[model samples]
Target: MTQAKATSGFLDQVCWNSDGLVPAIAQDFNTGQVLMLAWMNRESLALTASEGYAVYWSRSRKSLWRKGESSGFQQRVHEMRLDCDGDTVLLLVEQQGGIACHTGRSSCFYQRFSDGGWQVNLPVIQDPEAIYK
Candidate 1:
């Protein structure tokens, strides 16, 4: 097979969603805490694998979002896994700066749905304005 065909086949194994995206989850390698969930396209997945860092498809920005490019909270990948159905990507990584959520918490899933409402479970590590500065 040609090189292009080979590359295409490799990525084709992934069951991309209707928008050509896959849900990627980054988990803390040491604590097993789920750091965040993001979307990834073929290009971002390839870049993340090649660079050993978390790179995601920014749906809001409509471009590649290099983790920590602005917040200095990058994720150094330790391992990557594809789900059995090939529809999900799991990244075991060391989260730099001990922060993961854009809201300045350690994880994006910081809200607990208890008491019939969402409650804050984690405190903000750093102000987003400060981090994004």
Candidate 2:
């Protein structure tokens, strides 16, 4: 679907969990492909909307983070969605500048387990240094 069609939905009804957070999944809008998943509290959500970028709550680091703050491969928010349960969220983004994966791959989903071994599915699309400082 076009971004304009995808963006017409409301973001106010999205249900935040008890901790005031929602699980946000970042997907490639054109391909309907998932790229990454993260959490966002009310502040982060608001920040994302106001800033026109994706802001996430880091469970591991217990902090707020803008995807690619250091890498410069930011995900610009094209549209945001709430699932039927209201517990999950979806973000359609225009990924800027470079690969989203820190491992030098275009995306994080680069591995597939085969019959007896692990296989790399996609190639690293861009060098991290070209975008990251």
Candidate 3:
């Protein structure tokens, strides 16, 4: 089958929201740690599958976001899976530069609920200023 045909078939299995978006979760391939969560539209999902990387639809910017386009922390997807309900996507990826979070942490879920409030449990892997600039 053609690449476009295959992509369309796969996309057809997903149940996208009214905005044509599905929640995508990026996870560490080896460690099984969730790195980040983003949203993807059909175009972004097809691009990600074809490009073998993470591509997301930025609701805020109303555009396609190529992961690591500016930060140089691209996620090389090892595998992709859809949830049973077909509402979410899981990407097992090798996080480049050992960093996934924009805050310079290994993962975006760095905050832990403490006894009273949220607390930072993970240290920043690198300075965000250096990573972005």
| Candidate of highest lDDT | 3
* Candidate scoring better on lDDT of 1 and 3: 3
Instruction: Give the winner by TM-score.
Output: 3
How would you encode candidate 1's per-residue C-alpha lDDT over 1-133 as one tens digit per residue? 0112224465788999999999999999999999899999999988887778899999999999999999989999888889999999999999999999999999999999998999999999999999887
Clashing pairs in 1: none
- Candidate 3 residues lying further than 4 Å off, grouped into runs, are 1-5
| lDDT of model 2, residue 97 | 57
For all candidates, what are the clash counts?
0, 0, 0
Worst 10-residue lDDT window for candidate 1 reads: 1-10
Per-residue lDDT value at 69 in model 1:
95
Question: Each candidate's root-mean-square deviation in Å?
Answer: 4.2, 4.3, 2.5
* Candidate 2 ranges with C-alpha deviation above 4 Å: 1-12, 116-118, 126-133
lDDT of 3 at 5: 30
lDDT of each: 0.90, 0.77, 0.92
TM-score per model over all chains: 0.92, 0.77, 0.94
lDDT per residue for candidate 3 within 1-133, as digits (tens), equals: 0223344789999999999999999999999999999999999999888878899999999999998999999999888899999999999999999999999999999999999999999999899999888
